[model samples]
Target: MIAERTEQADLLAGLRPDQWDAPTLCEGWRVREVVAHLTMPFRASLGRTMLDLAKARGDFNRMADTTARHDALQLSAADLLACMRQNIDHRWKPPGGGTHGALAHQVIHGLDVTVGLGLDRRVPPERVALVLTGMKPRNIKFFGTELDGLQLQATDVNWTHGTGTPVRGSAQDLLLFVCGRRLPPGRLSGTESP
Candidate 1:
């Protein structure tokens, strides 16, 4: 979704100053905080990540939340968006994660804001595919839980994971599912929209 983010960032950059403080789906975080959080992960060196780990008590999500909370760039959403554009392609290694995992973070974070704001830009199909394919193994460690029991099958693409009853829909729907949105009544295991 790097390319899509480039396009998406352009849209975000143009948002009025007032919109930067808008609420996003990420609970208490505003759009500005989300942007700051996204920026904090780029090329985090061993030293910085270790500091984060200590701050998070070794939880990546906790670490990210902490960093975002403590980030100095809490003001000036325009500057944060500009930083996002500059760091859009920086390829964060996250101490021990793959580029695909970064792709997941990027797309999902994009959705957290876009979906919250009712924007129309979509994450690129290839980027989504890479994430869907990689989630099987990556999420085990990253999510600190089991996704094995969950069946994810995309309606708009040839995609499925796991083997039980399937939650199926367009790629975006599936992305929404993994991001923890409720499956639409008829979107799961069928072609009909809910």
Candidate 2:
């Protein structure tokens, strides 16, 4: 987790100022909002998080979106970067989600910033494999992607999941797919590429 966070910090450090406003695979979020969302766990207390959750009427997605947007407006790009740097060793996992969840959070969100910016960053294969291994049905349901009849095959790594028509890509791209993210054209190839 620390390694992932540190690597992301390094990646963010090299971004051009305008890149911070670039749209990500996260739909409505830009680079700033994604970084703010990534660093949120480090700064928000459990009670505060619960309050925000309540404010969003128990919708985790809404709360997350609200907080990310709010924090993005409140903090500068440099401040978000510093928050990530300072919490590289912090062990805050999503509720009911253990260490793997934390790692997935970092890897996916990191990709949100990198891939969204059209940067050619490859997540370490082992890390991608680990995350793939940890994927659960609930995670997919939460993302709301319909993968019932589609197979996910990673061309760059020895990982494959699901069944039916194959959707092929590098493991990281597959990860993004499973998380309900659509990649730019050519990132994925298959009958059911999204």
Candidate 3:
């Protein structure tokens, strides 16, 4: 989590002011919104999070989306980055997932911003492998991917998953693909289009 946080902070720190408004792979969320979402767990209190979950009728997805959108409007890019840096060592854990969940959150969202911007921010293979190993079937489904008959092969790493129509790329790209991002062209190829 600390390494991912530092990598993300460095990447965001280098972005031009106008880039904050750029679109990310997270559908409606802009770059700033993604950053805001990244820092949400660090800034929001347990009571506030509970209230938010309640407001969404216990839908964690809605809570996260709405909170990210709402919080982005209240924070600047610099503030978002600062929050991330400040909480690099934070031990925020979800109900079922502990530190691994936090690491996955950081890595995946970090890719959402970087890949969405068409930037060349490659997450280290070690970190990507960690997240890959931690991915549960429910987690993949929650990310909106249907991997029933698909295979994932990482060209830049030894990791591979599933079997059937192969989707191949670098470990980072493969991670993003599994997480439901339509990667930029040429980043991935399959025996047939996925």
What lDDT does each candidate get?
Answer: 0.69, 0.91, 0.85
**Model number with the top TM-score:** 2
Give the lDDT ranking, best first. 2, 3, 1
Off-target runs (Cα >4 Å) in candidate 2 are none
* Global Cα lDDT for candidate 1: 0.69
- Residue-wise lDDT of candidate 1 within 141-182, one digit each (tens)? 443433455676886677877676666666765775666644
- What are the models' TM-scores? 0.79, 0.97, 0.94
| Clash counts for the predictions, in order | 1, 0, 0
Query: Model 2 — which ten-residue stretch has the worst lDDT?
Result: 185-194
Note each model's CA RMSD in angstroms.
3.7, 1.0, 1.5
lDDT for each residue of candidate 2 in 132-161, tens digit (9 for 90 to 100): 989898887888888888888999889999
Best by lDDT: 2
What C-alpha lDDT, on a 0 to 100 scale, does residue 133 get in candidate 1? 72
Q: Across residues 81-167, which tens digit of lDDT does each residue of candidate 3 receive?
A: 899888878888777878888888888888888888889878889889999988888888887777878788988778999988888
